[model samples]
Target: MQFTIAEIWEHTGLFARMIIFALGAMSIASLVVMAERMLVYRKSRSESRDFAARMGAILAKDDLDAAANTRPDKNVGHLGRVINSGLTAYRVSSSSKDVAVESVARALERQAQREVQSLKRGLGVLATVGSTAPFVGLLGTTMGIVNAFNLMAAAGSGGLGTISSGIAEALITTAFGLLVAIPAVMAYNFLQGWVDARSVDISESSNEFLDMVARHFGGSHS
Candidate 1:
């Protein structure tokens, strides 16, 4: 019997329907996380580049105050935050050059950790959903096969139509699962690359800041 879309929906088994619903929810969650993370990474990358340029010039002038003041107000980009943290520690230990270096080093390390964690926010969800979605789809497919067999057994003389309808309905869940998972996986990979690049930028900025601080204090302490 040929079935219209509405009839197909009406005949969809409860298990298949539930699996489809779950896949839809996962798709929504992945999309939300992907959008949020993209914005955050973009902001961090843009602001950090600007902050680095400004701070480089400030340090060139031997102006520590100017470097500290280079902290951007719009968004505390990774570079600004790391520099601020190290500078704060350096100022607190200004009495001794060695102590100041040690303090800044520790502060930068802690701040870097926090920055990495921030960059990774929402990534776990994307990864989890991506990795599990295909399996979830497979499970739905298996359930559909089971359902098809059961329907066939119940309708011994009904020919192929009895099992074919159930099989067809079940396959839809597998397709839906793949649709949800593919984009999620792609987004996760793209975002992960951005996070890694940003992390490198933050690390380089930290090292640059430390070197500047050492040079500025080395003259006085010598």
Candidate 2:
């Protein structure tokens, strides 16, 4: 007996068909998340880099007021947001140098955490799809096998056609599951690495901003 996709699909019961459709949806969702995240990260990095270069020049002059009021269009990137938070605190604090520094540090930390969490949005969906797709496929496979056995029992046949059809029905769901799962796992790992690298960039840039703040306040980076 020869099996084709259409043949196998025609033989599959309602539950197995639903499983395949669900897996297809999962694959589509993963791809959409990957594309969206990639675009967001790319835009964020470009904007942050440009903002850093411009701000670095301003901060190098030890011009706290200039940096604090440097709101260029308010379309800032991740690093810019963190740095801007510190600058906002610096601009408003009428307290002593130590108190201002503490406040600025706190602001930077809070914004950095928010930025990181924002970058990590939709990652949980990828993680869930990667970890669960296989099991979901297995569930479909189980149903397929049960249906195949029921058909065989109804026909009261132990022939080659019956056995082959049963095997095809039982295995197609598993194959579809893996097809959906593998790419999701890969995309999750790649995007996750990007987030990690961006996190490091945020941390390092936050430190640099703090140093500039301290120096402008006539203190040290420490």
Candidate 3:
């Protein structure tokens, strides 16, 4: 059951390859998540800024349509879409006494929530991968250790050299798994924060827009 470092390397050849492949996959996934989240945050931030400026102009001039169309799709995030929905509803309901502005506002709020959820899509997958990768690595390590022990028992030797290869392979896989997990977890948290912050900004701006509309329509309570 005696093993040398060279034997360990030889025995772990395929396992090393598997670990490398797993690490690569994890890296790619993390990168994709980071890029997608960055794009979403950037678009939302830009849209919110433009919307704020346009809204300011609309408030001063009392031009609802102009404000509604100000940024269009580029500046329109989930919040923008919701605000547009409420504005459209309010305009259409203007002639009907039964249809209230509050009703339109509520509808838009619901739509906004849906958009938020959509934006948050794929986050769960990233979190799961991040949280579980280390455990998976540990599992690999445990298996490797078991195999090393089995080899030692088969060899009927107490020589550490005999099992060193298997142990090394196990350690290598575990390290690889952690390497994958660390970045995934970090990216998930960072993106979550970014999304939350942008969402807050979007909500605040939308609220302001809603209040402006309410005042224009002579609705009580902003």
* Candidate that would win on lDDT: 2
The per-model lDDT (C-alpha) reads 0.81, 0.86, 0.71
Q: How many pairs in model 1 have backbone atoms within 3 A of each other, for residues 3 or more apart or on separate chains, i.e. clashes?
A: 0
lDDT tens string, model 1, 1-222?
Answer: 456556656778888788888888999999999989888878887887776676667777878766565545656687778888987777677767777888899999999999899889999999988988888878888998898898777777566766877777777778878889899999999988988887887788788878877887897767
Task: Tell me the tens digit of each residue's lDDT in model 3 across 144-216.
Answer: 8888898899999978778777788888777878888888888888878866876786577667766776666
lDDT of 2 by residue, 88-176 (tens): 99989865778888899999999999999999999888998999999999999888778777778998986767767877877898998
Backbone clash pairs for candidate 1 read none
Error of 1 at 212 (Å): 1.5
**Which ten contiguous residues of candidate 1 have the minimum total lDDT?**
67-76
Q: What TM-score goes with each of the models?
A: 0.91, 0.93, 0.81
C-alpha-based local distance difference test score of model 1: 0.81
Query: Per-residue error at 194 for model 3, in Å?
Result: 1.5
Q: Residue 201: error of model 2 in Å?
A: 0.7
Model 2: runs farther than 4 Å from truth? 219-222
lDDT of 2: 0.86
